[model samples]
Target: MSKKRTGVFVCHCGTNIAATVDVAKVAKEMAGEDTVAFTKEYVYMCSEPGQESVVQAIKDNKLDSVVVTCCSPNLHEKTFRDNATRAGINNFTCEIANIREQCSWVHNDKAKGTEKAIKISRSVVRRVNRNQPLDAIAVNVTRRAMVIGGGVAGIQAALDIANAGVEVVLVEKQATIGGRMLQLSETFPTLDCSQCVLSPKMVEVKRHPKIKLMTYSEVQELTGSVGNFQVKALKKPTFVDPDKCKLCDECTAVCPVVVPNEYELNLTARRAIYIPYAQAIPASFTLDESVCLGLNPIVCGKCKDVCEADAINYDMRPETVTEDVGAIVVATGFDLYGQENMGELGGGKIEDVLDGLQFERLCSASGATKGHILRPSDHTEPKNVVFIQCVGSRDPAKHCAYCSKICCMYTAKHAQLYKHHVPDGRAYVFYIDIRSGGKGYEEFVQRTMEDNDTLYLRGRVSRLYRHNGKVRVLGTDTLSGQNVEIDADMVVLALAMVPSKGTTEIAKVLKIGRDKDGFLAEAHPKLKPVESVTAGIYLAGAAQAPKDIPETVAQAGAAAAKVIALLSQATLSRPPLIARVRRSHCTGCGMCVDACPFIAIRLENGKAVVNEALCEGCGSCSATCLRAAIDVKNVTQLQIYEMIEACLAV
Candidate 1:
């Protein structure tokens, strides 16, 4: 090979790195290398002038490769790449050495930090020397997007993406599109009716021509990569034709079978043939085959007989559908942490104790008690109600360690709602600390305390038990330094928000990573909050973390924006870095196939072949090949050896 020509540029990053590390000394050390054609220092390498200088040097010296020593590559790698491209050098020939975060911020000693920076630059230089010019391969993009989950987040994302003129497939696991948001009575801070606000979006999703709303459906399998994905969804049988059904209550009134309504948290009863609620999006009825008497042995067919529109069908079977899309949005939302195992909090055995969601149902106008705040054990109204915050949150010993972000604000809202309903009722909120970080949230909490006369105590509810027609709560007031006791008529626990059920399974299907707490992992917590590490797949709402309504909607919009951007491209450019297999060294052990997480490799004609379009350049197959038959296109064994040698060079 011809002699290598390298250019190095070090950035001060506006005193972020210059304050600790000597930028000029690091640049001078890099220039000492034999192949170093040019070296320079700048206050901000990402600035237009600095980039132009690097481009000018590459042209002036006819340099083949460049090294930029600056902040983390995550921040400015694209800027430097664009600079190299504009300067007539291949973008892949440029490498970035992070000195700001890895060297300066972490180290206190200036000399040591400078040494580390020089070493990092040397390794990058060696790596760039082995780099070859490569072109980004083009793949056709499908102008469509898929949204999982039918909650507020999913609805928002589907609407936004569809509004951008891209076709959207919204797959909902429930019979209705509205998820937990429909169950809520009134939203916090604004006090707007949850259904009133969410119902309009639900209708829009159902009516939009570009949006294909699939309720009672779930993603069974996901295959392919960004810009071209095949998703198979299983549509569960509702046993009632949505198109033919008139959504009248005639069938529900005549059905003899009665079951607990899950939407009401089992506090109310509904017929076996029923709709989720009055404002259900499709305006259709669903027959629960499990509870219906007509399905097995045919004891009764009253619902089918009573249907005026003749929409009942007991023989309906599940159907699977496949869709092609360019991008996917995961807005599966969250589930409240269960208190069944929390024995200290009465283990949900107390007659009048309930979770936040159940309380929300009770406060709703369509609830069992007609929106009256009555104790479940009796039909009478409760004179005293106790609200407990952080029941399953911030308690690493028993539950999750992270704070359930919405609990504090929602608990305050719950207190205010209760006060509004029962003028003579006394509401007591026990909390470790109030976290009202949203707009108007702190003032809303204050209104609950002062205007509504609700009592806020700083402490945790240690225990609860039924005593003489009242719930006895035992805990201490940390602020007052006093042991406290209360005999309450009802109790509500603000359970932690956990990633919804089957989220992990879905993540596995999509080949996406999740944090230890089971939430989908973002590419970067700050910069790439909405994008998942997996390309073309985005996250929104509580699926990523516990976020309130406004935040969830904003994230949904952000994910939609990413989808729109992806769909806008006429053809997507697949990374040039991908694995390659040598047919001559063929020992079709198939081990590499199992090791390939992206499923980009397969055995054909007794030799392994790679699907370059599907490959993510992860290099797992290359590492697993025992006979050295596989090698990643740009990253090879020789490059790694050269980098290590350069790092250890005296």
Candidate 2:
């Protein structure tokens, strides 16, 4: 074995390190080492001139490996690797030692910072000495993307990715493509009709040449990794053929069985065979086999008799589709916190007590009351309505601790919309604090107060019950220090927005992570807000966190851009740092099989085998191995010991 010649470069990072640590001293210390061929210090190694100098030093010193003491590898690891590659060295021969963030910024004393920087650099040098030159593994990228969920976020992502010349498969569990956005009557700030803005996008998704719309479908399994993901989606039967069915209401009119319309939040009744709403994208009806007469037609078959297109099919069964996609965008949207959880607020027992979506129905022109804004129990106008904010939110003992981000603005919007429909009606709101953090959001809240004369009380309701045929809300006004009581005709609970049902399950299936609050976890909360820890998978909308319409749309577009960027690449170059199993030292105990977090290790031919593509180099398998059969590439147990010795050395 020959001695490894390493080149070390220290970066000042424009006083980010120089102000706190001795960069030149660290470079000089590394130069004194026997393995170091040369050392250099620069103001910014990431700068063009600095990179040029590094390439020049590598060439002049005939260095086998390069070590950069600078910022985190996340920022400029690629820059130095490409620098090495340009200088006729394998890119994997380059290593990064973070001094600015890990050493200088973390320490206040100059001596301590300089000492720590030198130790870190020495560890990198030692690690580089053991590092063998390797080539990047090129994985072919499939030129297609898949989007789960059919909300505004999912629709936007699918359309954007599809328009970018990449095929997209858009899957929605519901019969229609539109999510919660379709149920709303109006959106905030501009008061634009919700469907007016969303319907066009829905139509575009259906008509787009690159998009394959799969409504009434769900992803059952996700396999493989980035650039080559295999997905199995189960598409439930809608019974009515979208291509064959005409948009006539003949079938719905002839059907005698009426069930509560879920789209209207049970505020209205629809025939057993019906479309969700008038603006449903496919313009097709779906037969509800659960409530409809029977599959055999022995009980009733009125809908089949009235169908002009003969589109009714009782034998329609669920179909499974297999899709190969390069990337995935998860925009599963959110579900409102259930009213049953708010036991203090009548527990949904009071007839007039409604959730936010139910109130949206009352204001909608197509609602059962025909936009009358009447109380559900009495079918009469509520002269005084009470709106409670954070019904199941910000209550750590009973509900969530985080604020339901959109409640304040929507609550104000609801007040304004309520006022618009009923000029004579008065609205009062109870809130801990109003969080209106968006363009024109504060102004909208102000208008609700000043223009609509909506009363704003800062507090929480302790109890709610029916009194004298009206809902009585008992709570304290914290600002005024008064125990206020209000007997309102109707009460609307601004329920907390929770991650949509099956979010955790879907995340598990995708092998992604979720936060404590059940929202999808981003790779980095601020930097990589869209990408998941799992490569090829991205997140959008309230599925990641509680966000309003504008934010959700923006995130969706950002996610689409990420997908397009991934699909545009002909082949993806993965880092050489992956796990390898030494077959000679193997004792097929299968401990690593269970200990591996990524499930990358498996027993093959009575020996432990590793799938390099699936391994993230987390070292969990290696740590669990007793015989030291597992070792991560670019890293070794000897290098770890040398690093520890370097840190402890005087």
Best of the candidates, TM-score: 1
Candidate 1 local Cα displacement, residue 117, angstroms: 4.8
**Model 1 residue 67 CA deviation in Å:** 2.1
Residue 318, model 2, lDDT = 90
Against the true structure, candidate 2 has what lDDT? 0.90
1-650: candidate 2 lDDT, tens digit per residue: 69988999999999899988999899999999889989999998898899999999999989889999999887789899999999999989899999987988888999989999999999888888888889888989989999999999999999999888899999898889889988887889888988889999999998999999998888999877799988999988888998899878898888888988888898778888889988887778899878887766676778887788999988899999999999999999888998888888998888999999899888877666777899989789999999999988988987988898888988898999899988999999999988887899999999999999999999999999999999999999999999999999999999999999857668978979999999999988788999998889999999999998999999999999999988888899887688888889889999989998778888988999888877878788888889988888877666787888888774
lDDT scores of the candidates, listed in order: 0.89, 0.90
The local distance difference test score of model 1 is: 0.89
In model 1, the worst 10-residue window by lDDT is: 293-302
- In model 1, the runs with Cα more than 4 Å from the true position are 12-29, 32-34, 41-43, 98-120, 248-259, 270-273, 289-294, 298-310, 396-398, 582-609, 645-650
Give per-candidate clash totals: 0, 0
